[model samples]
Each structure stands twice: as C-alpha cells, then as structure tokens.
Target: MLFELMRKREGVYNEDRKERTENRPIEEATVPEYLVFPLAMHIGAPAEPTVEKGDKVKVGTLIAEKAGFISANVHSSISGEVIDISDQPTIKGIAPCITIKNDYKDLEEPPLYSEDEELSVDQMIEIIEKAGVVGMGGATFPTSVKLSPPAEKTIDTLIINGAECEPYSTADHRLMVDHAKELIDGVRILVDILSVGTVHIALESNTHDSVEEMKKILDKVDHINIVELETIYPQGSEKNLIKKLTDREVPAGGLPVDVHTVVVSVATTLAIYEAIRSRRPTVKRITTITGEPIQEPKNLLVRVGTPINHLIEECQGFRSKPGKVIHGGPMMGIPIKSGRIPVTKGTSVITFLEKEEAVRSERTPCIQCAECLNVCPVSLQPILISQAYENGDIEEAERLGAMDCIDCGNCSYICPSKIPLLDNIRSAKKEIRARQEEQ
Candidate 1:
C-alpha cells in the first residue's frame, strides 16, 4: 500500500543548508569551563534542582531531577561543583538553571539500567523516562510519554524521521550518515517496545548520502524499510511525513498516535539506543552551527549546558559580526539575543547570520499574492489566519485552523511583503488554546 508519491505541495526549495556542517564530520566540543543545565529543557514542568550551589558532581550526575511524569531529568555533562542554581540565559529566555564549573576530571555516575538483562515494554519505558530522552527535533516532548501510547490507540506504524527538511540544518543528516547502526538499533527497540507492525526509515531525497548509508541496513530487517522522500520543507512534520509515507491524514487537532502511527526524529532514535545500552542520559546532541557569518561552520557533538559562545569559539568566532544567533533553523528557530544562552536538549542549530541575511525587511501589507498559500505545507490559508489574528478575531482564526499551525515558518518565509504570517498565526494559536482551556 505504500509507494513513493511525488505529489508536491506549497513548500519552497531553498538550498540554505549547505557550505557548513552537512558534509563535515561531527566534532566533540571541548568540555566547556562551565555548564548551565536549564531546568526546563523539555515540555511540561521544569525539573527541580536536587543539588545546591557548591555541590560537587560528576558527569551523568543527576542535578535537576524531573518534577512530574511529563518532565525530563537534567544531568551534569561534566564533573563539576554547582556554582549557582538560578535564572540563566537559555533559548527560551532566562529560566532557572543549574550552573556547574567543570573540574575537568570528567567523573561519572552509575548507569540507570543494566544491559545484562532484557527490558520489557514497561522496563523500557521506565529506563527511557529516567534517561531524559525527549523529542530532539525541537518539540522536546518527553519521549517516554510517546513510547507509551494510550491503550485505546492501536499503533501500527513507526517512522524514524530522518527528514532534515529545514534549510541550513544538517545535524540529523550527519547523524544518519555517521551513526546508522545505532539509529537502526533504536528503531528495533521502539518496534519491540511498541509492538508495531511495520517501521519506516524516512529520509529526504536531498540527503542521498544518508539514504545510501541507511539502505545498507534495511535489508537486515523484514518489517523495516527505507522511504526516500522528496526534498520539501516541513515534510518532517509528523502529519505530512506520515501522509507521504503511508497516505494517512492525521485528524485535525489530533496527534500521530490518533492515526495508529508514531514519528520520531532520527537523532532521538540514536539517543534511545545510547540511553538503553550505554546508560547515558540525554546529555549531548549533534548540533549544526552554520551560516555565512560563521568563520568555520561545522557540526559538533555538543554537551548539553554548553554556552553558545563555546560554539562561537569552536567555529573560531564569527566571520563578521553576526546580526542574529538563532537556536535551531532560521525558519522556525527561536532567536537568542545573546550567545551566553546555554544549549539545551532541543538546541539543534546555532545559526550566525550576517545582517544582510538576518535582518528583517520592513513589513508591507499582505498583497493577497497567495505566495504563502502556495508554499504552505499544511494547506491552511495563512493570510486569512494572519488577517483574523491581526484583527483580533480569535474565533475566526480558530475556525481557520490556527491551532493546526505547525509553526513551520513557511508562510513567513514565502510572504512577498515580508509579512510575519507565522508570528501572527502563532499568536493566534496561543489565544485559541487559551480560549479552549477556559472552556
């Protein structure tokens, strides 16, 4: 029933993902002199600090433990003493963080789970939860919650999302190229845990190298297959990805689980393998630091809590004074006003754009050119949503599927007038959700 469907849509093809880390090997960043573990790396409630200032810790030591079932644990990426536990610069602005000054010993903490024994579904869930795995694709949803779908949902398909669809981002591409075995192993574990019928390793056609690397392992498994997707923006969205791979339309305001499917980022899959086997927490991630402003753009195996300046230094500082430093891809990335912002589990790309590429042009009125609609991956009328939103018509925007806006930034990127359609839609979505909550 599954075949390659080349039905193109409202997505733009911009090759801004080149000239940097996509082709370079991932390098391990030197242990930063200091680390700052944000208590709120994942979604839901932030973790509570378990260690006070001045408490010596080792690599993998639990510093800020999960506060609730939906939260993720925060661990020390290096051996150090807690210098402070207070508000610090993070991707999401100033959030409480546990600051540790590295002792350089790189000491360790014991593994959370032993590999000598086989783990059942429940055991796997427990280990994954404790290991602090989350949606590394920037969603940062607790991975454990995802692995344990509701009893009512009969999940049948598992998709390993290797679609690094965003321009100027290639961390996942590099991961797929360098760590195919570990990625596949993670797929196997998820299949076993979820008891899914079939698994698909979906990669965009642009990343032929990654596709070739993964194709080598596809033959070893019967239920698992390689799905080469057309190079398109936001195809990595679970709904879009599922439709391209399986032709299943995820219901409005519903999750992929509603369609008996789950789509996890490939980086997250690799984390699963390492978390279960090596007993490592979600302490590090492969980040693509690129853009014309960077002197030596390359990918780095960055430890969580490393400062943005650490990467700037690793890249030999900026080529020219960067106009913007965004955390993640330019399209959907949250802007970091300062490089002091520490990297989190969700931090994927540290883009340093020159003023020419970074500065926003003066916004003109929407021309109804339908360019946004033409490139919208979700088929929603972005201008309509933005109009309703700007006019403060919350109900109208809600009716226009504002809540369904994936924040892909395609609408904003494609606007002829440089209208901030995505931002307005996002504002509308927040209001819509608030209205829903009030009910």
Candidate 2:
C-alpha cells in the first residue's frame, strides 16, 4: 500500500494550511433563536416531515421520518414550536426544512437507551438504523446501509479514519482528543457488526497525540491497531484511505467493499458510539468554524439545526470583511452564498477565506504540465477529463475516467494556466451519471 503513496508525496498542498493551530477545547455553541431542520441531511431521499407548523415539540422529537432504507431520520435538536415546514437554505441549496422557534426548555421525551447488553449483528443494525447515524465526515451516507454490506461480499477489514487531511478541518482531531473513549467504543461496535478480526485506525502522523490517546483507551483490544498516515489532502477519502492502508486499489467504478473492506471517519465512529450507547439520534455534531476572517477559531459542539450566524457570533464574529465562506475545507468544500444555512450531520468546517485567498484567476489554457496527474491523489489525468468535459464529449470524459476524479481540487491548485480541472470534471461526471440513469 505504501508503495504508491511513498513514491510521490507533497507534504502540504496549496490553498490549504497544514495546521489549524487553534487547539482550543470544545466549546458549546449558544442555542439559536430558531433551529431549521433540513429533511434531507443524509445521502438518500429527503426525510418526510412528521410535524406540522405550530406543533409543540421537545428535544429529540422526531421531526422527520426516513424516506427509504438509505435515508436517515431527522429530529428536533431544540425544544420549541414548529414555526413552518418550508424550503430553507442549506449547504446543498434550498431544501425543505422544519423551522422551529426555540423555547430553551430542552425537555426530552425519555432516555432511549436504558441498558447495555451483548447485541447481535441484527440488533446492532436495528439500533443504528433507528438512530439516524449517518457519516459525519461530510459524505453523510446512511450508516445502516454501509453496515449492511452484501452477504456475498466477505468484509475482512474495518478501518477507522482519523486522518483530518482536509486543511482547516480538525473536527475529527478534537473528537479524538476530547472524545477518544467514544470513538473507540464506536470502533468496537463496528468491529462486532462487521465480524472483522482486525481493525486499523488511520490518523495523520501530524496528529501524534491522537494516536497515543486513542491507543491508551483501546490498549487492551488486541484486534485494533493504529496506522499513522501522511498529512496529505484527501487522505480521509474512503477509496484513498483503503489504498494507502491496505495496498488495494478499488477498480474504476468499484467500492471499498469490492476490496473486502469498509473505511469510516473518526467523527462517524463517535456518532456510532453515541447512537448505540446513549440512544441519542443524530441530532447534532461538532464543527470547526475557522478562517482568516473570523475573530476566534473554534471547534464547536453545535446542534443539528443551528444557523451559521449563531456560530459566527459565538466565535466573536468576523475580524475582517469576508471574501468567501465555504461550507467545508478549501479543497473539496463548496462555497455558500449565505451564512443562514443550518448545521447538519454532514457539517464539518465553516471556512472563510480573506479576499486575497478567495481570488479567482483567469484560465489561460491547459499547459499540459502533467502536474495535475502528479498531484492527483487518485492518479487520474484531470487535464484530459477537463478537456473532454469542455468539448461536451461525455464519452471521452467517461473514457478518461472522470467518475474516478475525487474532486480534491489538487489539479486545479497545481495548474499554472489556472484551469478549473476539478470543477469541469465534476460537471462532466454529473452529466455522465444522468445519462446512465436515463438509459
């Protein structure tokens, strides 16, 4: 596995800072006056709203039900009255949200997990599905579906990804530091569910303290081992992590399971533990709100539906005029038009770039420098794919393996001509998928 990654490695890519440097302890975000719950926080179809406007609700109340087996449930993280069931701005655009006015009473229905017992795989899956635990690392894939791999596929490895490779995103790092026990328990739960004998937890070597801390908590578990990885961007992506750790490259259009493994993130693991241990549904998550424009850089324990404005204020507001506000890290994160977007299970970092940092240069034509191919974590030729996309040749883009592009933006960062390689390929991939669906 190290053979491929070892040959070429850039310690830190452009457009990203290696260290977030805040290192502050987790702080509780102030409850917003209103909480907006987007019904479609997860990967699949949007959840169906269960509450109507004006319905009185408490914390942990089911606000939406799962629309399909691949969807996760949505709950009210605040005790308030349902103000409206209308389209609200989200990181993914305007989605239907259950708007609530916070009363600040925070009363709960009841404790969902009363006792702990040896749970069978079926029982474990049931609790996980009911808890609405999706991947908190930003993918937001339904965890239950990941746990329920096809029976024909023999899952041999379960890897816990703690590599906070995305620059300006250390939500996972804080989770490992403050909630190591929770992360470990989540890994153990996954161990039992997958029936995998050995578990490898991968963290960037920069986060050495996290490895020591997690090892101390999981020292007795012989089946678990810690794997330190290079602090490279996109190291946390499932396919990339699988290859770097296990020496298995998922074929084009293949999944981690094709290599008999499943890779999960540190935040996702902690979410799993919380859902099973406390029976707490996926109602909230810790997010990193940082950048050059913010007054204070913080890792906050924010409720699911809390607005970004609340967090910005909690962080002491902006220090300078904001140039661009990204929904995640600068590399793969999307730029948001506004800050009113509510927090969701997939929320990671709210990155604000200064005017200079957000500057977009003119694209001069591809220089064919092959720099993109060298820096691409997936080793795909981004220039060819971008060319294919620019020509509107979906077949050429498909032939160039556009779908294999991880959208890491490394190519765009490396291009001297300032071509938008990742964005172009991304558009082409979307069209390719739509064509496939049409067929």
Candidate 3:
C-alpha cells in the first residue's frame, strides 16, 4: 500500500511537469556585448595571470596558468585587449577578475588538436588536467582529480547526471537537446578513461524529450543505459541519484567512489569532451538568464569572466526591481548582492527574483510535522540538527547526523513553518569540520 501511495505521488508530479515543459520553448540568446573572465573561478589555487594590462589576447589564448594539481587553467573567451587584470567582483561575492575589452576581432588561437588526431586515455587525461577543466555543475571540483582515484578502488559504473532538478534552471536541458553529440562523446571518453564496466545516463522524468533525444543517439551504441528517475526535488544530487538509480546508499561521511561508482554532471562531461578532443580549457559556460524581472528568458553561451551586468543587458535588462540576483539555480544557489560579479566556470544560471518571490519570512519553531524528514533524500533529521544549531550544541548535532546533510535544500522547501533547516545544518557541519581541523 505504501509503495502504491509513493507511485501515485510520483505520477502526479510527472503530470504537472509535462504541463510546464509543454508551455515553455527552449530559446537561445545571441552573443553578449562583453565578457568579464575572472582569474580564480575554480576552487583550488588561483591561476597565475600570464597576460598584462593592455596586452591583446585572442580567443582560446591562455590568460592564466594553473598553479597546482587542484587548479584549472583560465583562458580568454574573446579576442580582445586586456583592459585590466585586478580585483573585481565575482559570482562568489568578490574576487580578482580579468576585465577584457572585446575588440570583436574574431581572431582564433591555434587549434589545440587536429580533427584527425585520436588521443589515448593517458593523453586525454593529460589534456584535461592541463586545460584546467573542473566540474561545471557548480561543485567546481577538479575533474582530473576525480578521474584519478586510487588503484585499489575499482570503478564499475559511471553515472552522467542529467536530472537537472533545480527549478528555473534550463541550461542542462537545452544542452542535452542542442549538443547531444558532444555529450555522448564525453560519456565515451569518460568510459574509456575510467575503464568503467557500464555507463548510465540518469534524467528525471520531467525531461522526457531530453531522454528521448539521448536514447535516439545511444540506440546505436552498446553498454550505455538510460535510467528515468522519479521527478523529485534534489534528484540531481550525486548521493540521491546514486540511491535512486542503484539503490545503494553512499555511506555517511563517504563519497560516491566509496561505493564503486563515479558521478559526473552532463555539463562537466561536455567540458571534458571539449578539453580532450578540442584541447580547450574551461573558460566559459552556458548560463540561463530567466525570472519574473528578466525581459526575456533565454540560454546564453557566456564566456567565463563576463560581467553579470553584461548578461542582464543582453537579456534586455530587468523589467522591474529585482529582489535578488542568484548565480545558480534557486534551490541550491547563492544570492549575490550585485550583478557586477563576473561569470565563472561553475556558474550555470543568472536568476533575478521579484520582491514577492525573493523575500523569506522569519523562521518559526518546528512543529514536529516530519515533512522535512519525509522529503529528505538523505533521511537526515533536519529539525533535530537545526535545534542543535540554535542551542549551540555542535556535538549533539554531529551525533544526530548533521554532517550527512547533502545541503540540497529539500528540507527547507518542505518545511511549512519556514525553518531554515539546511542553512542551520550547514552551519553546524561547518563548525564541526572547523573543530576537527583545529584539533
């Protein structure tokens, strides 16, 4: 009976999703006026700037060099003059950025590889590492590091995340439909590199067309399977996707690799394809500009370091006062104070929410309704962890499994009393990690 109830809920969710997709058309945007590429977009050590102010750089020219194993290379998105290489606002609050004044010259850098050349797995890994390619789906973890796991841990399955379950984010959806070939090539590259036994492309039932398109392409190929996931909030999460697809719970305080699996985002896979096959670094990404305030919602292939303001203007600027400007999707993205920040490799969307939609009410006491727990894909007790945070009991929170929270924001979404469950849980987790580091 319980299984039947769950199936009924999933069916209703799928119906609502079909209606939404039917109403929206996948639209694309033309090139923007200017792109502000930043130096330190990825997580590791900031790339060292190679070009100075006033230097002319061509598209695909290396502007910044990787400084460490965990870092990624930075490149010029357009053939332009280096207007300035100094501190500038970035999507992650503020950071040093390289301002390139586009000359619109359309000059190209020498091709990194010839079309006829075929690279071995080692060569591909070397190219990807040097290109500074990282996970483009917001995690920004160095892709090479993930590809080079320890020898003892045998990898059998490589899961490509196409779920894209976040609300108001369509970059992945459009990419799957538009760049199907590149995505598939990327999957093949990963399969070869990791020597994985099988490849699975997991997409939510919400994106049936994307699945259909992918299936049409994969029909000719072997060993690649498409798994349709239940349309649920946070279905795109690495842990949650692993659970729903394989029925394998990633052990608490463990990673996906611990269970003999590796998950990569569709965007990251595409980036890998470009890096290995084309010999290009990750210097730009597709960002969706959409919201109530946005004049026209569309997907743009923005160069890394393009200022947020340039994108807003390209989208015909906002129609009214925007209550908040978020760099990624609404559910898991961080809200930026200003659009002056430049785009980065990890940025996938620029969302502007109106006042009514953006404002959050004050938090209230938990009513012990257990809605959060029920919806939580990780099965963590958000109410208890949040209570521990309020009372400043770090150890209690840790003991109650606060650290296992995936920070997917589903608990916060399901809470009726407006409790900031994920936020508090994140705080508690941070404190716990800090204490461990200090000790």
Candidate achieving the largest lDDT = 1
User: Model 1: runs farther than 4 Å from truth?
Assistant: 1-8, 435-439
Count: clashes, candidate 2:
0
The TM-score of candidate 3 is 0.89
lDDT of each: 0.84, 0.83, 0.78
Model 3, span 286-354: residue lDDT tens = 777887788866787877767788778777787898988888866678789866787788988777788
lDDT of 2 by residue, 1-439 (tens): 0011222442233334535534777788889889899999998889998899899998888889999877988888989899999988998788899999999999886645567576678887887887888988888999899999998989999999888877788788888988888888889889888989868999887788887888788757557989888767767778888887788989888889999999888888887887788777777799999987889889999999998988999999988998999998887888998778998999988888898878888879776778778877777888989898989899999998998877777777767798988889989999999999899
Give the candidates in order of lDDT, highest first. Answer: 1, 2, 3
Candidate 1 clash pair list: 10-375, 17-168
Clash pairs (backbone) in predicted model 3: 35-306, 36-305, 36-306, 37-305, 72-132, 73-132, 284-304
Q: Native-vs-model 1 lDDT?
A: 0.84
Candidate 3 clash total? 7
Model 3 bad stretches (over 4 Å): 1-34, 114-117, 433-439
Q: Rank order by TM-score, top first?
A: 1, 2, 3
**lDDT, candidate 1, 1-439, per-residue tens:** 0111122366766655565677898889887898888999999889999999889999898888888878998888899799998898888778898899989998899888766888878998888898899999989999999988889999999998988876788899989889887887788889888888888888888888987887687655557888888777777888888888888998888999999999899989988998987888888999988888888998899999999888888888876887777888777887778778888899888777777777687899777787787777778999999999988899999999988888988878777698888889988988887887799
